[model samples]
Target: MEKYIEIRGTNLFVKYLNPDSRKPTIIFLHDSLGCTKLWRDFPEKLGNATGCNYLVYDRLGYGKSDPMPTNPRPSNYLEIEADILNDLLIKLQIDSAILFGHSDGGSIALITASKYPSRIKGILCEAAHIFVEEITLRGIYEAKELYKNSNLAERLEKYHGNKVDILFNAWVETWTTSDFRNWNIEHFLHNISCPVLFIQGEADEYGTMAQVEKTVAQVKGKAEKYIIPNVGHTPHKEIPDQVLDRTIDFILQLAH
Candidate 1:
């Protein structure tokens, strides 16, 4: 069911798939430009595959949630997002959960797992970045061009509605700023005590293998990596079957 949950003083849009199930919750976090709807049917599919409940939400500034201030976002915004996720879990009475996050969301999942280790069961990070890379900037630059010259805004409007421009600029302006060039979150990786599965596409334009390698290298608990060839940044979207199968296997293993 569609619902609005007050979190961090804002009504964040949320949806639950298989909420009646007695299985563990797998919370899905979207990318920079994504919302609960943008995750498409992956949450339902994953929930069925893993026999888990699923939760997906739009952050404060994306989807149907309240818009954030247009001021430059901090480099620690992911950390803030992690805290907010924890708050949402508490408000929902969820004691522990598995996080499935993509891009910026992936980074947030990692941060949440590390900073609030007691509540996280496991994490699945897809195309998550631990440090800024030159390719990331280049990809952002190209995306900015697409936003300006193509129907990118129109396309995103299908999912984001009127909040498309604000959400788009928030990500573009913040990431492309000079101050954000050195942004990194590797320090928090070591604190994560839960099992982590790092999934990346071999052809991801925004980041390289270093992102996954560094994540698996530093985490204190059990960790695994899966690099899907011929796929770009969004594996759940690009190759749903493979991503689902692998993800289900990982979660099943975690259960044992």
Candidate 2:
């Protein structure tokens, strides 16, 4: 089911699938420029494979959700997003959730798991960054160039519609800022007690293996890493079968 739910006073676009109250819900969080639609059928496929409920939503400034109230977002934006996710779970009465987050979404999941450990069963973070790296800045710079020269903007428009510019600029501008360079959430890592599965591509342009290594080393809970060879930033999209198989194994183990 798809609908607009008021979250933190903002109308956010949400989609729920395979609502089985008896099973844990797998919440899929998209990347910086992604939304509900951008997740495509992965949620459904995963939901069916695991026989678990799944939820996907567009963040405040992306997709069908309300636009961000302000531009040049604060440095703690991801932390705020984590708080919003916690509130969302409370409002929805979701007692158990396994977060599957990518990129920015992955960082948000880590933050949420640290701050609100009760509801989170586990976390699967793909290409999540704990701290800003020089490589990350380089990737963002390249993306900015792509947006200006290529059809990247036009392609994003198909998903974000008129709000495309705001969403794109928000990502580029915030990440490029000097203050945001020091934006790091590593302090929250020690607080995450729930089991975490860190997945990343060996060829990821935005971050290095340090992202997965440090995350695996810091988290207080049982942590594992899956480094896919020859894959870029998005491992799931690049190799769905491998990701699906591994994710299913992880979630099934958690269920038991």
Candidate 3:
């Protein structure tokens, strides 16, 4: 089901799959340029296979949600996003759920778990950065060049509409700026009490194993990691079968 939810007085788009199931909900957070629509059929596939309810939402300034103000964002924006997520879950009566986040979404999940430990049953992070990396800065720079010279904006228009420019700049301009270079979330990792699974691509241009290892080392609870060979940033999209198999096994084990 597709619906519009009000979070912090902003209208955000949400899509639910197998919402009535008795299983715990699996909430998916999208990457920098990602929205609910970018998730495509992954949620439906996961929901059907696991019989778990799935929730995918667009954060403010991306997808169908309201735009962010045209100003520089604070380094702690992910922490702020975590707080907003907590409010959304509470308002929707989601007592607790497993969080599945990718890239920026993954960082948000980590912050959320650290800030609101009781609200998350488990967490899975893919290409989630704990701190800024030189590789990350280079990736964003290349992506900006691609957007400027290619049809990327036109393709992204299908999801972002007129907000594409705002959305793209919000991610690129902020991350590449020197003021945000030292951004890191390691301080919040120790506060997380739930089990966590970190997934990364060995060939990822945006982050290194340090991103995954650093998070796993700092997490207070049990943590597992899988580094997929021959894959880039987004493993769920690039290697769905492996991701689904691994995720299903991990999540089902949490039930016991």
Candidate 4:
């Protein structure tokens, strides 16, 4: 069943699909410009497939959550996300979680997992970016061009409300900047002490297998990566059944 919970200043709109009683809590974090709606039915479908506690929530200023007046810097983001997520879990009375994050959300998951090592059961990072790359900048530049010519803004507007500019510009301009190239989280990867499963599409436009490979090399835990062929950035959305199967198998192994 699904219901809405109210945050002190903002209403926390929630969508739950199963009753997870003592099962590992699996929290789904959306992509860079994704909301709960963008995930469509994956959350519910996966929830039923595993019968574990599945949760998906919009980040502040993204979906139903309160929008911040400014975009947060990358260095400050992971910690801030961890703090906010800790608070959110407390409000929901959940003390631990198994997180699944994609793209930017995957970075957020890495941050949270590294910062609060004791609060997580496992982590599944999909299309996660650990360092900046030339291809990344080229892709962002292409995205900016496409957003101007295509309905990218229109499609994103549905998720961000009328202030699409507030969300889009910041994400684009920041990552592609000359200064943002030095963005690296390899130092923090050592702090993550739980099991981690890295998922990435072979043809992901945003990043390549290195994102997952580097993580497997750095993190001092049981870590592995699954690279699906002929898929793009949003593998779960593009290949739902395959993604569900892989995720289910991974989770089941952890369940033991």
Candidate 5:
């Protein structure tokens, strides 16, 4: 069975797999609009495929976790997230882990690896946003319009529960912030000190291919890239089987 524990006065909904395996644990973090449930069964499939222990959880305000307060543009959102992660691991008796994060989760994973290199065995990032771009802002503006009219919000509400607005607004508002436009975390990439796999979709609408190309160019570490030909921002969800296959093979390489 899986396990869960609270951290910083919030319920962190976490699921653990392969309890008997000595392999490095994989901690999966969802995208900006994603919650644990939105990932569907990819984590479980990958866990069994790689034979490594796996964990998947919702961030505060997403999925079954507690709602987050407004104003998340902290200079230390990532720092605080990393701290909470360590606390959660300690509470659950887990030490080392490989973080697999998507979109915003991917950014968080990068932040954590840069700051707490010792705790991470590796990191796998998919469709991560490094810096803001005009395309990103425009896409977010369209999303805000969708939230006002389309059934997307209602559909997503099923995954985020009553805190749907909190999750959606946090993502849209933060990225839309004037000060956040110049935000770039590339400076911290060199400090990762661990193997990384970067995956991006050729058709990712929210972020440009240029950002991923920049990461491929700048990150001074063992990093590999796999760009899906015909997918959107959420490749893991848009094309799960292809991603699952690529991820399983890549993660297994670290086993030995």
Candidate 6:
């Protein structure tokens, strides 16, 4: 179930659970500096709870996947990632998918659902950013400092290995760039007609409530929001039971 699959000429580390199942697949996308291994057992637990197959993969330049070119990434990188996800779905022969994405992965999920509505059945995104915010930049700046001063890089190495620096730099440098300030994906929201659930922590350090509010207002889909009190950034990891219960209810409702 775990193997390397060539996606757009890059070998991506992919883990597929119950690939032969006829039920819709739930594709789990990790946050920046995260990989297939970082997702741990959340995918399996969710899959078992919903009786749905699940897929998890390391993006190029992360985990067991092939490295990417070391160059400045363009502002539209998330959109490019969305295109890659579409191709990956085609290569894997997945007819339908429900995306569960976190952080940067959440943004990618929104873009993918917008561009490929037919292939996407629904979306559940946590802490997804549509545009640059001062709070977001502050969080990244703080993280950059932590990476330089603390053992953050060392901890990340356990998951990303030698590719940790590249992945971390890719996330920090790209988001902190001045040109990326105007980098917004709101234009694509109206194109997303499928159901979407935007989940975020009320105490999230990286973004504010505006992120969840604007997303629910802009998306053309039947949009809902779940703002978890006292949680920060990652609700699934912080309060797995609450997230699991809410997500299960969401998926079950989608079946009707």
Best lDDT goes to which candidate? 2
Off by over 4 Å in 3: 18-21
**Model 6 lDDT per residue over 122-227, tens place:** 9999999999999999999999999999999999999888888888898898998889999999999999998999999999999999989999999998999999
- TM-scores of the models, in the order given: 0.97, 0.98, 0.97, 0.92, 0.94, 0.98
Number of clashes in every candidate structure? 0, 0, 0, 1, 0, 0
Which regions of candidate 2 deviate over 4 angstroms?
none
- Full candidate order by lDDT, most accurate first: 2, 6, 1, 3, 5, 4
Please report, in order, the local distance difference test score of every candidate based on alpha carbons: 0.90, 0.92, 0.90, 0.79, 0.82, 0.91
Output the TM-score of candidate 4. Answer: 0.92
C-alpha root-mean-square deviation, candidate 5: 1.6
Candidate 4 clashing pairs? 61-67
Off by over 4 Å in 6: none
TM-score-based ranking: 2, 6, 3, 1, 5, 4
User: In model 1, what are the clashing residue pairs, if there are any?
Assistant: none
- The C-alpha stretches of model 4 lying farther than 4 A from their native spots are 1-12, 71-75
Best by TM-score: 2
Q: Record all residue pairs in model 5 with backbone atoms less than 3 Å apart, i.e. clashing.
A: none
For 1-256, candidate 3 gives per-residue lDDT tens digits of 8888898788888887655646788999999999998988887787777778889999998888888877467778888999999998897788668999999999999999988888799999999999999999999999999999999999999998999998898888789888898888899999988999999999999999999988999999999998899999999999998999999998887656
Question: Compared with the true structure, what per-residue lDDT tens digits does model 4 show for residues 30-142?
Answer: 87678888888887777777778888988766777666567535645655766777777777777568888988888878888887777787888989898987777778889
Output the better candidate (1/2) by TM-score: 2
Superior candidate under TM-score, 2 versus 4: 2
Assess candidate 5 and give its TM-score to the true structure: 0.94
Residue-level lDDT tens digits of model 5 in 49-134: 88889888888877888889773656446557767777776776676788899888888888888877877888899888778888
- Kindly report which residue pairs in candidate 3 clash with one another: none
Q: Give stretches of model 1 more than 4 Å off.
A: 18-22
Model 5 lDDT, residue 160, Cα: 81
